[model samples]
Each structure stands twice: as C-alpha cells, then as structure tokens.
Target: MTKTEKTKQFIIEKSSVHFNKIGYLGTSLRDITNLTGLTKGSIYGNFENKEEVAKAAYKYNAKRIGNKIISALNQSPSGAINKLMAIVDFYKNNWSVIIETGGCPLLNAATESDDAFPKLNIEVRKSFIGFTKIFEDIIKNGIEERIFKHDLNIKEYASTMVMLIEGGVLLSKTMADKEYLNISLKRIENLIHNEMKL
Candidate 1:
C-alpha cells in the first residue's frame, strides 16, 4: 500500500477498538491521537474529521466480525444444514472475543449512530440487512437442494434470524451472561432443524 493508504489504515486500525468500545459521541479526536500516538494535525491530515474516522473504524470492526463468520462458513463441510450450524458455532465460539471488544459493532453503531450520525445510522442498518442476506442465501440454497422445507418464508426467517442473533448479542453483553446468547443461538438451531429442515 502507498504511504497515504498505509497511514489511513493505521489510523483506522488504531481507532477501531476505541470507537467500538466507546461510541461515536463518546470517542474523541484526542482519544484517537492518544491511541495512534499521532499529532492532531496528522490525524486530521489522514481523515476529514473524527466522523470520517469513526465510520471507517465501524466498518473495520464490522469486517473483523464478518470475516470470522466467513472463515467459519468456508471451512465448514458441505450441506446447507452444516453451514447453518457452523454459523451458530461461530457465534458460540466468538462470544468471548466479541465481548472483550465491547459487544457487536453493528449493535453498538446502531444504538449510538442514530440522530447524531445519520450516515452512520444508515451504514449500521445496511450492515444488519447484509446479515439477513447471509441467512437468506443459506436458506435459499437449502431449499434448492431439498434440504430445507419448500414453504419456508425466506424473508421472514432471515430477518428473524438476524434479529434474534443481534438481540442475543445485546442481551448477552448487557447481562454479562453468555447463556443468554447461547440460548438464543440454540433456539435458532432448533428453528432450523425442526421448522426449516426437510
């Protein structure tokens, strides 16, 4: 990468955790400067302002979480059911890691970005919708392969699945109880096996 790109990337990487752990309004330019050990002008030189950096940091954080699930999906064996289960397994395994980073990025962004950061709130919404697409694709493939019920409501199921997962993460993080998240995921598993599966 070029020097400019590298420096911007450095700022994003350094500030991502800070933004995720704090919020858009909670994090300050000074916090980023402190985290990156860069002067205020240097940070401003790389980013238009703190808002721009926060947006990139949100995306960076979201990508980190998404990549984990994508890796799980890639390593998973064939069968739509197995892929679906692999998603559940990914969440179960990654809960601690996610908790350390101050909960899920999309959730954090959604809660904080509203009213204050309109663009960011939109990005957060897009991120959640993107999550729904993953489940939709999985279910669609399952139905195509005759692995899932033919009559499944793809949109409803996908949206519900994503909502439940996000809710689970929220509850788990807020309550400091992993079981809440596990229970949510277990319910999802049961929903797939009993209702969606053929």
Candidate 2:
C-alpha cells in the first residue's frame, strides 16, 4: 500500500474500537485525533469528513468479526450441521474478545446510526442482511444433505437467529452480564439440535 493508503488504514484501525464502543454521535473529531495521534488536518486530508471516517471505521470493525466467523466456519468438518455448530462455538468462544472490544460492531452501529447517520444506517442494515444469509445458506445446505429437517422456514429462522444474536449482544453489553447472551445463544443451539436436526 502507498503511504497514504497505509495512513488511512492506520487511522481506521486505531479509531474503530472507539467508534464501536461509544458510537457516531458520541465520538468526536478530537477522539479520532487523540486516538490516532494524527492532527485534525492530517485526518481530514485523508477523509472528507467525520462521517466518512465513521463509515470506514464501521467497515473495519465488521470485517474483523466476519473474518473470525469465516475462519471458524471454514475449519469445521464436512457436515453442514457441524458447520452450524462451528458458528455457535465461534460466538460462544469469542464472547470475551468481542465484549472486551465493545461488543458486536453491526449491533453497535445499527443502534447508534438509526437516524443521525444515514449512510452508516445503510451499511449497518446491509451487514445484518448479509449475516442472516449465512445462516440461511447453512440451514438450506443442511436440509439438502438430509442433516436438517426439510420444512424449516429458512427466511424466518435465519432472520430470527440474527435478531436474537444481536439482541443478546446488546443485553450482554448493557448488563455486563454474559448470562444474557449465553441464555439466548443456548436457545439458538437448541433450535438447531432439537428442531432442525434430522
């Protein structure tokens, strides 16, 4: 990467956690400057505005978690059901890492960007939709392999899994209670085993 590209990425890496932790409205230009040790002028020289920085930061945060999930999914054994279990264990095992870093980036961005940050709102929504499709694809493949029930409502269940997982993240973060997320995830795992499994 060019010096300019590397500098922009450096700023994104440094400020991404802060943005996800506090949020768009909560984060200030000073925060970015302070976190990255870059002057306001230098930061602005790289980006058009605070909104642009925020959009890029959110992408960085989301991709970090996505990479973790993808890695876990790829390493799982052949069965589709095992693939789904790998996703569950991925979240469960990474809870500490995620919570320490300021919780799920998509949830954090979506909640904070609801009205004030329109561009970010679109990005956050797309992230959730993409995540939901991962579950849908896994379940569909499981059914094709006769490892999961054929009548599963792919759309509803996939959407619910994403929604519930995000909700658990919020509760866990706010309450500082891992049990909140643990309970919700248990429910999801139960559905996968008892209801979906063949």
Candidate 3:
C-alpha cells in the first residue's frame, strides 16, 4: 500500500478498540492521537474528520468479527445443520475475545447509534441487516437441503437469533457472568434442533 493508505489504516487500527470500548462521543481526538501517536495535524491530514475515522474504524471492527464467523462457517461440514452449529460454537468459544474487545461491534455500534451519532446510524443498521441476512441464507439453504423445516419464517428466525445473541452478550458483559450467554446459546441450539430441523 502507499504511504497515505498505510497511515490511514494505522490510525484506524489503533483507534478501533478505543472507539468500541469508550464509544463515539466518548472517544476524542486526543484519544486517537494518543493511540496512534500521531499529531492532530497528521491525523487530520489523513482523514477529513473524526467521523470519517470512526466510520472506517467501525468497518474494521465489524470485519474483524465477520471474518472469523465466515472462516468458521467455511470450515464446517457440508451439512446445513453443521453450519448453524458452527455459528453456535464460534460464540461459545470466542465470547472471551468478544468481551475483552468491548463486546460485539455490531451490538455496540447499534446501541450507541440508536439515539446518537446520526452519521453512524445508517452504517450500523446496514451491518446488522447484513448479519441477520447471513442466518437467513443459512436457513434457506437448509430448507433446500431438506435439513430444516420449510414452514419456518426465515427473516423472523434470523432476526431472533441476532437479538438473542446480542441480548446474551449484553447480559453476560453487564452481569460478569458467561452463564447468561450460555443460556441464550442453549436456547438457540434447542430452537435449531427442535424447531428448525426436519
């Protein structure tokens, strides 16, 4: 990459976790400068403003988690059921990282964007819709394979899974107990096995 591109990426990488942890309004130019060790002028030279940097950082954070899920889904067995299981296993195994890194980026962004950060609201909503659509696609494929029930509501089921998972993340993080997430995930597994499967 060119020097300008590399510098922009560097700023995004350094400030992403801080944005995820402290949030958009909470994260300041000083924080970015500190994280990136770049002077305000240098940082601004690479981006139009803090909002631009934040948008890029949010994308980076989302992609970080998205890539992991994609990898897990790709590595799973050919069966559609196994793909769903792979998603469950991912959250079960990776909750620590998600927690440590300031919870799920999609959840964090969505929560913070609801009342504030108008610029980010659209991006956050699009990301979540995209995520829910992933589950929908899996269910659609499962139905085609005759592995999942054909009568299921694909959109509702996918949306519920996202809600349940995010709710679990919030509860687990707030309560300092993984059991909350465990319960939620267990419910999802039950739904898949009992409700979704044929």
Candidate 4:
C-alpha cells in the first residue's frame, strides 16, 4: 500500500477498538490521537473529520467479524444446512473472542447510531440488512435443493434467525453469561432440525 493508504488504514485500525468499545459519540478525536500516537493535523490529514473516521472504523470492525464467519462458512460442507449450522457453531466457538472485541460490531453500531447518528446509522443499517440477506440466500438455496421445507417463509425466517443471534449476543454481553447466546443457538439448531429441514 502507498504511504497515505497505509496511514489511513492505520488510523482506522487503531481507532476501531475504542469506537467499538466506547461508541461513536463517546469516542473523541483525542482518543484516536492517543490510540494512533498521531497529532490532530495528522489525523485530519487522513480523515475529513471524526465522523468520517468513525464510519470507517465501524466498517473495519464489521468486516473483521464478517470475515470470521466467512472463514467458518468456507470450511464447512457446501450444503445449506451445513452452512447454517456452521454459523451457529461459529458463534458457539467464538463467543469469547467476540466478547473480547467489545461485543458484536453490528449491535454496538446499531445501538449507538440508531437515534443519534443518521449518517453512521445508514451504514449500520446496510451492514445489518446485508447479514439478513446472507441468511435468506442460504434458506433459499436449501429450499431449492429440497433440504429445507418448500413452503417456508424465507424472509421472515431469515430475519428471525438474524434477530435471535443478535438478541443472544446482546443478552450475553449484558448479562455476562454465555448461556444466553448458547440458548439462542440451541433454538436455531432446533429450528434447523425440526422446522426447516426436510
């Protein structure tokens, strides 16, 4: 990467932790400066404002989480059911890492941006909808392959699946208990075996 590109990425990478942990509004330019050991002018030299950096940080954090799931999915068998189960297992196995990274980036961004930051909220909404679309595609493929029920409501099921996963993450993070997420995954598994599967 070029020097400017590297520096921009450096700022985004360093600021992501604080943005994910503290939040968009709560995090400040000073925090970014402290995290990157760069002066305000240097930071501005890379980003237009704190808002721009905040948006980039959110994308970086979301991509980090997305890439993990993509990796897990890639390793699983090439079947819709297997892929769905892989997602559940990914959360089951990586809850600690997820928690350590300041919880789900989607959850954090949505919670903080929903009412306050309209510009950031747009990105958060797109990221969230993108996830639901992933689940929907999986379900659609399952039906086409005769692996899932033919009459299933793909949209509702996909949305619910994503909701349950995020709900569990939120509860688990708030309650400091992994079982909340485990229970949620258990529900998904049960639905897969009993409700969705052919």
Clashes of each: 0, 0, 0, 0
Q: In candidate 4, how many Å is residue 38 off?
A: 0.3
Q: For model 2, state the Cα shift of residue 70 in Å.
A: 0.4
Question: Mind giving the per-residue lDDT tens digits that candidate 2 earns over 21-140?
Answer: 888768899999999999999999999999999999999999899989989999999887788778888878989999888899998888888988899999998888889989999989
lDDT of 3 by residue, 158-193 (tens): 999889899999999999999999999999999999
True lDDT of residue 72, candidate 1: 99
Q: Per-residue alpha-carbon lDDT of model 1 for 1-198, expressed as tens digits?
A: 999999999999988888988897799999999999999999989889899999999989998898889899999998889998999999899899999988999999999988889989988988888888999999999999999999999999898888888899999899999999998999999999889988
Error of 4 at 141 (Å): 0.8
Query: What stretches of model 4 exceed 4 Å from their correct place?
Result: none
State model 3's lDDT.
0.92
- The weakest ten consecutive residues by lDDT in model 4 span 17-26
What TM-score would each prediction reach against the true structure?
0.98, 0.97, 0.98, 0.98
User: What shift in Å separates residue 63 of candidate 2 from its native position after superposition?
Assistant: 0.6
By TM-score, the better pick of 1 and 2 is 1
lDDT at position 48, candidate 1: 91
RMSD of 4: 0.7
Best by lDDT: 4
By lDDT, the candidates rank as: 4, 3, 1, 2
For each candidate, the alpha-carbon lDDT, in order, equals: 0.91, 0.90, 0.92, 0.94
Tens-place lDDT per residue, model 4, 7-120, is 999999988988998998899999999999999999999999999999999999998989888899899999999999999999999999889889999999999998889999
